[model samples]
Target: MNRFLQQPIWRFYDQSISMKYNSPLESFATDDTLCQLVGQLQSPPTIRTWVHDAAVVLGIQDHRLPYVQQGMKVLEARGYHPIVRNSGGLAVALDTGVLNISIVLSEQAEALSIDAGYDVMVALVKALFPEAADKIEAYEIVGSYCPGSYDLSIQGKKFAGISQRRLRQGVAVQIYLCIEGSGAKRAALIRDFYEVSLQGEETKFAYPQIVPSVMASLSELVDASLTVDTVVIRLQQILHDLAHEVHMEPFHDEELTLYSFYLQRVLQRNAKMLEPK
Candidate 1:
């Protein structure tokens, strides 16, 4: 286990319930706000879990795709809202089955190394599923969207990817866990997205050649009956045991104002990125 995951106190934020009403944009903005609040010592270390109905979160580099808009249409046609996220990574599919977790920690004492932050998330995830402790592996899964060095996998099939955002002396390490549905199906969507976006035309950046077979959900990899709700329960139990005090704290009035500011920025950036080129 990483030292950062052993905080004495932790504030839990559960947004998984109201996922239908919230967009991925709002979630990203809330993360930014939490980053500021936690970094400034206004709040304790926080763990936020969220899920969105369905969206194709594109990375900044992805916005430059030759036929990006056409590719977005392919997603929208399939009921997936397309939006370029404020973080770094290639496009990732999100739906009711996928669980997104964010660990917001302050970096005031000393800046946490990038690798250290990623390791913290890897540790927490392994703790989440003890039965698969030895099975779970972290390495890049080629042919998967948003391929990264810390891609979480089991038996060579990826089920999660970790990305980090640092702002205002805080580090937000985020991961999307494919918990319930078929992970390969989600990867297929990204495969179609990239196929449409690239149209076989070469570009400066090398977009992933997504292979759907390279991914599998936790349910498929470990237990067929696993679900987001059950995973959430496990998360709470783990947090309770790890921290001396674990509780949910509502947003402060000041924090709400700050959240609004960050929300607008995210919205504006998305609008500009998705506009016709």
Candidate 2:
């Protein structure tokens, strides 16, 4: 158990239930805005929920693949706009069916560590589904896309993947929960992506050979129809129970300015790296 997980803070905000935009651009903008707010200590320990239309978010390493164009094309043909993210992990699918949650806090105050950040996300998921909480486990589901040591799963089927980003003194631990739709279909897309990108070339970075059966949406795993909104509401209930008060507020103007600067920097970096060199 990490110390950060046990630390009791005076201020915490559960902004996780807010209905956000469905556009990828808007979601990216919100993430940048929240990161800036956290960096400036203008916000409380914040939890945010977001969802975007069909989009394939690629990790930095995924962009380095020899034939990434083919992978992008495949995603585009399947109604997903492939964009490389300024974060760790390989390709991940995001659609209306998926709900993304971010927990942002000050590293100095939280005494945050890498594993601590992941544990926070794991704890939040367990809180969200108490009935299945004990059944949930965190481990690298071998054949899952964006496979990681902290992958959130139940009965060997992965439902979420976690990643982190730090800006200034703030650390944002993010997770994408597959709330609905066919998780296997999403995995199949990434499986095809890896095949197209690698094209039989032996690479040192061993991308997972995806087994679609090992992944499933929360709806499937819970045996009930679920949606992002339902998960979002549950996340709020959990956070509110844990916090003094959860404020529903938008980003301030200064935070938006900082986000603009950071967003441009991230986009520029992506463009330069993605461009044919």
Residue pairs of candidate 2 with colliding backbone atoms:
none
Q: Which ten residues in a row have the lowest lDDT in candidate 2?
A: 1-10
TM-score, prediction 1: 0.98
**Tens-digit lDDT string for candidate 1 (1-277):** 6788888999999998876457899999999999999998889999999999889899999999999999999999999999888888999999988999999999998689999999999999999999998999888999888999999999999999999988999899999999999898999999999999999998999999999999989999999988998998999999998899997876789899999999999999999999999
Q: Write the per-residue lDDT of candidate 2 for residues 1-277, one digit (tens) a residue.
A: 2233332432333333343333344455556666667667777667777777778888888988989888788889998888877778989998878888888777655567798789888887887888788999999999999999999999999999999987778788889999889999999999999899889998888878999999999999985767777777776566556655666666668767876776677677777767863
Task: Quote the lDDT for 167 in model 2.
Answer: 76
Taken over the whole model, the C-alpha lDDT of each candidate is 0.92, 0.78
Instruction: List where candidate 1 sits over 4 angstroms from the true fold.
Output: none
- Range of the 10 consecutive residues with the lowest summed lDDT in candidate 1: 14-23
Q: Which residue pairs collide, candidate 1?
A: none
Measured against the true structure, the TM-scores of the candidates, in listed sequence, are 0.98, 0.90
Cα RMSD of predicted structure 2: 2.7
After superposing all C-alphas onto the true structure, candidate 1 shows an RMSD in angstroms of 0.8
